[model samples]
Structures are given as C-alpha cells and as structure tokens.
Target: MRNTPLIEAFKENEQDLIRFLIVRLKSAFAAQDLAQELYLRVCGLDESFAVRNGRAYLFRMASNLAIDHLRREARQAELRDELQTFFGDEAEVATPEEALISRNELERLERAMAELPPLSRRIFYLSRFEQKSQREIAALVGLSPTAVFKHLRRVIDYLAAVRDT
Candidate 1:
C-alpha cells in the first residue's frame, strides 16, 4: 500500500513535531499521544486540499491540540479546588470521645473502600465524588445503569456492614 500524503509529511517531521509538542505539553508521553492524534486528524483531510507547506500545517495542528490539553487540565484543577473548598472544612470543635470515634470510623471506611473491587471503587467515586448520575457513570464506564446501581448498592452495603462492626 502506498503512503498517504499526510503520513509522508508526518514521517518527515515526526521528531521536530514531537519536540515542539513536548515544549508545550511538558510531558514526552503526552506529546507522543498528541502527535499520533494529529496524524489521525491530518489523515482525515481530503487529498484535494492543497497544502503549500506540510510542516507548517502539522505544527499548527500540534499547537492547537496542546492548547486544548492545557485548557482541560486547568478546568480539572479548578474543579478540584472547588471541591476542596466545599468539603474540606467541618466544625473544628469536638470532644475527645467524638474525635476518637471519627478517627475510627474513617479508618473503617478506608478499609471498606480498599476491599471493593476495582470497578466498584471507581463507580463509587464517580457517583459520590464527581456527583454523576447513574446514567452518566454508566456511559463513562461503559456499563449499564443497572450495573452501576448494583455496584453502588454493594458499596453502601459494605460500608454499612463496616459501620455496624
């Protein structure tokens, strides 16, 4: 099979393109993935589209992808900060017995979480921490809503059992 024009351009400029991406993305691995995505995007272009400078076109695509990555990372950081502000603080004053009970309860919850299956734990976090609906978690995790509900139910039951004992 013959190489497409896009592939040929990519082969010629792969190293320089990756170096440019790394400068913007700040991670070699992420730059490599972005470079591969750029290649796929360029491959989708019609052959009739005229490109006077293939290297310049590739650089522009890489730059745009890097910008998108930065914006997504910034949004995630902002969300994390907001979540901390909302849930980080509680009433500071407590009796010694109350504090001891809180600590023990926290330890039990941690152990309960640790005992969960990997997918079950992820589903719990997506539901509680991210506050996603069951339908949303199903779509994100590629499970049926029923399955998500079951996993969540399992988590609740486990935690309740931990609390009782």
Candidate 2:
C-alpha cells in the first residue's frame, strides 16, 4: 500500500465499491449503508496500512456482511409469502380466516410428512390416513407384528417434528 491516508483511501474507493454493492443489493440506500460500514471497519482496525489487496479486502467484508443481511431478509420474506399464498386456498363460505387456518394446518401436515423416515411414512400412510390395520401393514412390508409396533413407535417420533417447540 502507498502512503495514502486511510480516510483518503476510503473516499477514493467508496463510490466504486458502493456501485458494486448496489448492483448486488438492488438499492442505493443499502449500497450507501454498506459502503459506510466498510469505511468504518477499515478505520476501526488497529493494524497499520500494509495490505496487499486493500480494495479487495474492503469489498469482500462488505459483500459478506451484505449477503448475511440479505439472507436474513429473504428468509423473513419467504415466511410472509408462505402465509400470504396459503391464506385463501379453500372454498368460499368457509370464511377467508378459516381458509387460512386450514391451509396452514395442511402445510404443517405436509412438512411433517416430508420429515418422516421412509418406513415410518409408509407405515403412517398405510395405517392412519389409509385405514389399513397394523397387521396389514406388517404383511405388506414383510415385517412381523412386533417389528411393526417398533416402526409405529418411530413413526410417532415424527409428531415431535410437527410441534412448534
């Protein structure tokens, strides 16, 4: 690095870096915020200016922090979108509020089903929802009654996955 003052280095690189951040972040305000955060970080370091790639380092830190922020925001947006999409998927006269609750319960059941193990899923589908007996499930799956009971026990473990915790 040259004898350039850190504040000057910050000023010189700020616009280009903010533009880079804006391209990825899709907002002028967010780019400006991240760029300022980068400048502050560089100012806060205790080490002397001896970097081989100062610009790269500043951009790398900003990108990582920005990505973390975006990921958090995206996850929140996904949850909100999920709520919106499922809020009115059933019959009218069911009431839109009732429809929303029904849809959410069905989604919860679907998530629980997805989390089930293969044998547990089979046993569950065969027994409860499909109205098959444990003996019939055992016969179809080629397991004994006792083993079927064991499989059912494991299947109940999936119920915990459905719970909110």
Candidate 3:
C-alpha cells in the first residue's frame, strides 16, 4: 500500500488513457469500457509489483485491450458473413406471397435439419446459433476440429440441396 505508485500514476492519467483508447477503438463507449477494464486490472496487480513507468504500462494495456476487442468483433463479423452467405440475402420488405414462400422454405429447412444425425445437428447449432468456433464445438463434442467442420459442411450441403427443391 505504501509503495503503490501505479495507482497514483493511473489517477493522473485516467482521462488521457480514455482519450487514447477512443482514438484506437473509434467508439467512446468502447473506450470507456476498456478504460474501466484497465483500472480493474491495475487494481488486481500485487502491491509489491515493480514498474519503471506506470503510465506507459497502462497505455500499453489499453492498446492491447483495444486490439483484442477489435479481433473479437472481426471474428463475429466473419461468423455473420458465413451465415449470411449460407442463408442468402434478406429482403427488407416482401410481398405477402414472397413472405409465405420464405416461411415455407424456413419450415422445410428446419425439417431437413431434423433429419440429420444428432451429432451433426448439434455441431451446426453450436457453430451457427451459438457463434462458437469450430475448435470449441469440437472440444464440446469430443471430436477434432476438422471433424466438426466436416459435420457442419455435410449439414450445410444437405440443407442447401433441400432448400433448392
């Protein structure tokens, strides 16, 4: 407690840290969240930890957090794109007939999914709806990641064929 210079440094540079994160993250809301996270991390550090420069350490942590946030966002976007590509485009507006056709297709797709083996269906659900990575699904199902991907591909191909007809 007597030698916690990092806390003093953090108090002096808190606003500057927020501004720095905002520039890196491009959102004031995200920046504020990251700043709060940074503070929590600093608070968790051992009291006897040595640091030559606390401000530098804080800014570096902020930068790394921003990068990690961006990476997670990118991964989510990729997942969305994968699903969008699989399901095809969505029309913002649709006529009654078109809506009915889409609903029918959705029902058919659901039926086709039900026809799949339980493991394949589970993998598909985990990957698509849960937004889990293939490795994560594999770990859950006790299969290799490659096997999980194969399951997803098989189900997707089957669903596509069913949707076409």
Candidate 4:
C-alpha cells in the first residue's frame, strides 16, 4: 500500500473527517461517500508532493466536497421547483377549450392505463408517479430489472399508440 503523507494523515483523521462532513452535510451516508472520495483524491496526489499540514489539507478538501454537494443539491431543488411551477402555472393560463381537451386526454389516459395488465400498470405507476428506479421496482415487484423495464416499455408504447390515435 503506497502511503503518501497526505494519505497517511487522511487515514489517521478518517473518523474526524467523516464527522466534519456529517456536520456539513447532515447525512452520515453522504459523509461516508465524501470521505471515501476524499481518500481517493489524496491517494491520487504525487508521492513527492509536500504538504506543510496534511490534516489541514484533508479538511480543506472535505469542506470543498461538502460545499459542492450542497450546491448541487440546491441546484437540483431549484430545477424541481421550476418544473413544478411551469407545469402548475400553465393550467391557470389555459383557455377553456384547452382545459377541456386536457381533461379529456387525462381521462383517456386513465382509461387506457386501466385497460393495461395489473402488473404493467403497477410498474408504470411506480416508475413515473412514485419515481422509483427500475431496480427498486423490480425488487418490490419480485421481478428482474429487465422485466421491470419491459413492463415500463410496454406501458409507454401503449400510451404512445393511444395518443397517436
């Protein structure tokens, strides 16, 4: 095992690093992941590189990672809010005819979903409304991930055909 000064220091303060990250991120799991990332980063540094203070360097790296994670989370939250506002606000500006058409289309889609096999419908609901990953849906439904994908695909194709008609 190659032990650079930074890597050795990182190993020594690993638990403290995780605690610092957990304080910043408020997620022990995220803190663990960030700590792992920090270790990988330090390991990739040149062995010849000299650090006046290895612990400070590691803490700085961890802090930067936590800040980046928080910024990314904030950006995603903003995007979700934007999407909700865009979709929710659109209804207010819709003309009566457009609203009626949307309503009828929704009803048609519901009926088409109802016509689907129970498994397929359940898969579609889980994938879309519940925002579950295919692997997660597979686990819940006692099917392979590929089977879950196929079920979702069938539902999408059926809905597309209905929309086209």
Better of 1 and 2 by lDDT: 1
Mind giving the per-residue lDDT tens digits that candidate 2 earns over 43-93?
776556556667777778878867866865776787778876876575247
Ranking by lDDT: 4, 3, 1, 2
On residues 1-165, what C-alpha lDDT tens digit does candidate 3 reach at each position? 443788788889999999998899899999999989988888888998869998998888889888878877888899899978876797356789999999999999989988999999999998877667898898999999999988999999999999889
Cα lDDT tens digits for candidate 1, 64-142:
8898787667768989889778767663567899999999999989988998999999999988766677998999999
Once model 4 is optimally superposed onto the true structure by TM-score, how far is the C-alpha of residue 22 displaced, in angstroms? Answer: 0.5
Q: Evaluated with lDDT, which candidate comes out highest?
A: 4
Candidate 4 structure quality by residue, lDDT tens digits, 1-165: 588888889989999999999999999999999999988888888888888999998999999889878877876788789988888855467799999999999999989999999999999988876567799899999999999999999899999999777
Instruction: Give the Å error, residue 154, model 1.
Output: 40
Clashing pairs in model 3, backbone N/Cα/C closer than 3 A: none
Model 2 lDDT, full chain set: 0.76
- Between candidates 3 and 4, the one scoring higher on lDDT is 4
What's the TM-score of every candidate structure? 0.52, 0.45, 0.54, 0.53
Model 4 lDDT-worst window of ten: 85-94
lDDT on C-alpha atoms for all candidate structures: 0.87, 0.76, 0.88, 0.90
124 Cα displacement, candidate 2 (Å): 32
Tell me the lDDT of candidate 4. Answer: 0.90
Candidate 4: which stretches are off by over 4 Å? 89-165
List candidate 2 stretches off by more than 4 Å. Answer: 1-7, 48-50, 83-165
The TM-score measured for candidate 2 stands at 0.45
